[model samples]
Target chain A: MTYTITQISIFAENRPGRLAAIAEALESENINILAFSIAEASGFGVIRALVDDPERAFKKLSSLGYVVSTTEVIGIKMHDRPGGLREISRMLGDAGINIEYAYAYTGRPNAVLIIRVDHVDEAINAILSKGGQLIQRTELA
Target chain B: MKYLDPRIEEMPRTEIEALQFKLLKTLVYRLYSFSDFYRSRMKEHNVHPDDIRSLDDIVKLPFMYKKDLRDNYPDGMFIGGQEDLVRYHVSSGTTGKPTVVGYTHRDLENWAISVARGLTSIGLGRRDVLQVSYGYGLFTGGLGLHYGAERMGATVVPASVGNTERQIELIQDLRVTAIACTPSYMLHLSEVAEKMGVSFERDTRLRTAVLGAEPWSEKMRARIEGSTGIKAYDIYGTSELSGPLFTECSEQNGIHIWGDLAYVEVIDPETGERLGPGEKGELVITMLQKEALPMMRYRIGDITSFEDSVCGCGRSHVRISRIQGRVDDMLIIRGINVFPSQIEHALMSVPELGEHFQIVVDRKGALDTMLVRVELKSAQLFSDKLDDLIRLKNKVAHQLRNNLNVAVDVELVSPETLTRFEGKAKRVIDRRVL
Candidate 1:
């Protein structure tokens, strides 16, 4: 079963050294950033990260006065070769599952793609039908 | 013109001084006879009522500070008994315990008259509909403007703060001709009006604005006038001196203090030496006719200068410039004095920045660090790139350094993030232990 993986998002002022400060705070807490993305708005930036410890990272980041929230995302494991991401994207696209945002990291044998989509259940079914392995939440921990 | 009270408004300077002397003599004698606080204070200085023969001799009397009011607390300095009192108002006391002020029936009447005079000077009349937007109740702004507008025969809306949507609707529905509120709130109103598609120039009959209760600049006056299409005038007074008492006339030069009701003097804050005309210093005032609580030589802690010459409005009363800043609000950064108003003036010059800002002062080891967090205007916020934002931040910091003569850290934030105040806005947050 492709269970939902929780990802943490932090709202921060769009300024120099703000991201470094957040990174320093998470590093101090021993939280490893598995994947991360930065979304820039008009005068602020949102840092969305998939960390090894979502609960710990959320708590540590929030205590430092950063507006933070958690969203459920599905992670997929595909072959590390080219077309790994294309295969998963084609399956989700064929099923009409919209990917709101996505980020990826490649390991030696496999690549993990973190996908935030509108229809989570349909995307999971599409990935399963295409023989794509779903990364479980407990595997990161 | 249309004087609220022609006799006092038309009185000559010499006659006003004589009247002030007579009232000072009576007030000092009464204080010596009744209130132990004033009696001991006067005796400590070895001054008697008879010593005050002329207005110049008023300098010999002791000066009272805001701390004195706090030390006296609930009722130590009030002369009359409980039976003689008609009303009481209090300071906001955001810093500490509230200082109390009482008013007799006559005191209330005179306060109404003082405000009425100011309202009339700015061309408010019976035919005008005035929406009193200052907070009412314990704070003097609401009731002070209320009574004055009523006395001037203007239809009073009594809209005492914080219903923004309804306030705009009232302006449109009732055809409000004038408004009295803090200058910042007026800017907020204008912003809200624009969003709601209510243009004051086309949709409302608002013609006059009497802004006071906080220090504002001529730049702000020009901004308000340009946006709302109303003549923005400054009104000045403190709760201890009877709410808002003086206002700018049609000429819009400076505030015309009523000479017959209150005597004004500017003294060097450090030396207590009276400064000449056009010299800025601490403003000290003596109420000539307050019955319940007559304030004599009260140091109001505001920094301003006096204009000696007669105003173009044909009034001989001494006009004081807009309050620069309070002695208490002055920040000494790296041994240099800086007022928030100066910083505001600098920031307002830049069109990309919004009106809301916060001054955060912290001590980093042995050095004092000032961080100014200002909001970007909505249009600027949308169009600014990362490099442009950094350049804007540095530009603002450069401007602040030039104006304050002290380096400051400027942090540009998103629009509508910094807090907007409906009442007296608290802009400075000092975190230094000292």
Candidate 2:
């Protein structure tokens, strides 16, 4: 039933060493970045990540003047096969949900598909009804 | 204590009108006889000096626009020879050629007197140290206020624009009491002072500020007053009318237009019909005493109105309300007229947004688009939630649409990204031209 994962989004200008500065600050705070994605447009970039201790990391980054926001993204555990993503995406599409963006990481037996969609509740229902395993926050932590 | 020139400033209403009529007759006669440009303009309207029998007949004369000054250019508007002219100043000319204005010896003396009258009305006197922070050179704001403060025997600072830190240092060191600059610059100075750990309320002897040379709102006046702990007053004049002339009395109701020096009128800008007191319209002025370059029925593009009721300061000179905006600054968007000041007023109402913003206009396909990029005050820092920023943006956009009667795109920019101006800030960027 629980399918949501907390992701930290950091807004920063696309300049030299900006990401390095953010990473250095997080490293100094001993915060681990579980998964991350960078989306850039023009001269601005947003770094979205699933970090351990999202609250502490958010405060530390934001105190440095980075515009930070938290978003609830769905993390679905898929079979470690070729059609795993296609299967989950097809189910969500058939349920009339839009995938804003997505990022993923692979493990030995399975892969985790971190998805940002327009309709979170409907996506969760569609994934569970289609017999896909949902990743819970406790499991990820 | 009451009057700058008791004889003229205290003249009765009946005698004031009579004096304006007599001066208007003489000015018109002189222009008709001396300047070929005025003669041709008057002849085209089939009017002469004899046509002006009274002050009410001022409407009969042909209206002179800014184009008239631009058309004449260099020395064509002067009524006397080169030797008669002692000083000349040019307009900023944001759109086209700069208009030139000349001052005779008598004209300079009259200008000093007019500005001195304004300074005196605002309680500025010999003992106070006055800082003239307005830009000097071709622009008349600096020297105009400088000479006027000197004429009042106040110790003058002459700290022309720029060098905010040094300016603040001088104010603290010299214990400057009065200041003259644009309202935007005063806000910028306050920001710099805050960063320098200098508080105007506790760190300096600043008491009064005379802000002018651009249109600002009463909300801005209050902001300046609250930030600097000074009584902010609005002074009204242009280089064409002799820079930095009229100012608000201690009552701070409206600026007192020197009736003996310049006859003032308000008219419906479109129909050119004169508007009665309290009705908003274009301001028209006639310089009665200028000897070198005199303007008769010159339509200053500023939009304002008159307050006919006598002021609490006991000055009989007519009071002019704060300037709303220039006719040239009006922008037509989606068939609706929008003044940037209207947007500023709307933004000031919202406590979260910062004071700096730029209006960007662009035509997308067939429809025009307006984007107001505003900075968030540091106190309203964007939290780790997109909902807050989105909600604030929607709120500002809704407020702007309600105030401007047109939809606007509100972009919440990072604080301090927008340029801060040391002079009159240029806030509008029209990319439709590109």
Candidate 3:
């Protein structure tokens, strides 16, 4: 099954009250966030949100002085059985594309993995080149 | 022998202008034959190659602004190719694009002479150990003063900016005799020196300071001297015009314009009428002796005055008053003209605030509310001093009203709230519905 879902990404400084400001911006845009995760480094932080409307969320955060970026991630549907994670990693490793970081969670029947890599275009190319099926959020939901 | 020295720091006016005329004639023919940019600009203004016989005819040529230099960026406006150029310097753009200034071998020599003249004006010579605090890399201040100090045969200590502790250590350890940087930075060092309980006057060997790259006040000059325990002299020049074109002499009356290189004029900023002695206006400069990128007439956008009064130092070259402010920095708020520097002047009077602050302009309900965010010194930050803060805010508002003729909201922040910059502080933040 093919799935189409919106991705929301908010860029914020790793400072107090900054996260609240981003939340307020998204709330004002009237976009309902379905799933969200926040990853932070020393100086900067990125809050990735799977929202109902990505375009509105992007524009609102930008207007509120938050640097926002959006990216499409394929929510691959793999069996909840063990060794499925190894299969995906082995495939990406053989392709010579390094994974910077990855966040994973379970949604009922299938496991969902959010992978951030060194180069988005290169990773996408590698995944497509390997003939791996890309799963969308709509298909999982 | 005196006339042959490029460092004509002590030359009389008649001799300097005589040299200026001779150089101008040679420069005019060179521009006509070599630089298409200068020749076309001159021809467009009906300024003939021969019509620029004397310095007075310089007014006939159109004044070159930073915009003209920026329009032909990188290498288009330059007379020589990249291979012929030795170095390039860029200005900190406050209004428009940062201007890239190039220097050839001859240009470098001319710049060195100008800087030596500046150092000599402040009584610096071979015996002095010059501690240069200006940052290097594309900034003309660092390398400009560096080469000039070296040319004067002085012991050069190239201590680029930052690391306050190291700067203080070198000041004491190396026995540095003089410091050069922006005047505001010298004030910063003075404050730091005080906090560390390092006696700048007693422990260090600093005698004189050359401060420029920003227009400061006599009040600031007194503060710098009082704090640092050294006589401070202003070095005036722009990257567009080779750096350090004017320097104050021993008399310390006004800055002596290098009459041989650039013809200086003070014109009414609005009406463009040439002003007489002691009248402040936009400073206009004409490059009298330049080969590579000779600018005929250039409007500096700085407000200044001309004083023909004779100096005790005996240099008859015209003296320009301390630069008041820049026309480009002037902003209109509800039909009232205001400069961020005006706010700075008013804020400095408070004594409780540090020099670092930003003027934020934003629209509130169809009306403009100009907010001045000031960083208060540590001594003024007491929980019990709410009344003091209120009083300080009122005093700044009163000063702004009396001086700028406009109402501004003053916000007092803790020390180091506003960001400190390495060069040219971003003092103004305009968010006025634009």
CAPRI tier of model 3? incorrect
Cα-based TM-score, every candidate: 0.63, 0.60, 0.61
Interface RMSD of 3: 17.0
Model 3 agreement with the true structure over B257-320: per-residue lDDT tens digits: 7777778889987878899989889998877765556676688788899897666665567889
For model 2, how does the per-residue alpha-carbon lDDT over B1-434 read when each residue is reduced to its tens digit?
55667787767777888888888899999999999989999999999888888789888899898778867787788898989888988753323346678999888888889888888888888888999998788778899999988887889999998899999999999999989987767877888899999998899999899988755678878788887789999998888888889999899999998888999999999999999999999999999988888898999888999986777887788999998867777664643346777788889888877789999988663246899988766423444344555677799999888777669998876556578999998999976531
Model 2 chain B poorest 10 in a row by lDDT: B378-387
RMSD of every prediction: 12.0, 16.1, 14.6
Instruction: Give the candidates in order of TM-score, highest first.
Output: 1, 3, 2
| Residue pairs in clash, model 1 | none
Tens-place lDDT digits, model 3, residues A1-141: 333344666544346776676677778877776567776543444577777677788777655534456666545445577987877778788989776555666764467666666476677667768865555655533
Candidate 2 stretches greater than 4 Å from native? A1-141, B330-434
TM-score of chain B of each: 0.77, 0.77, 0.74
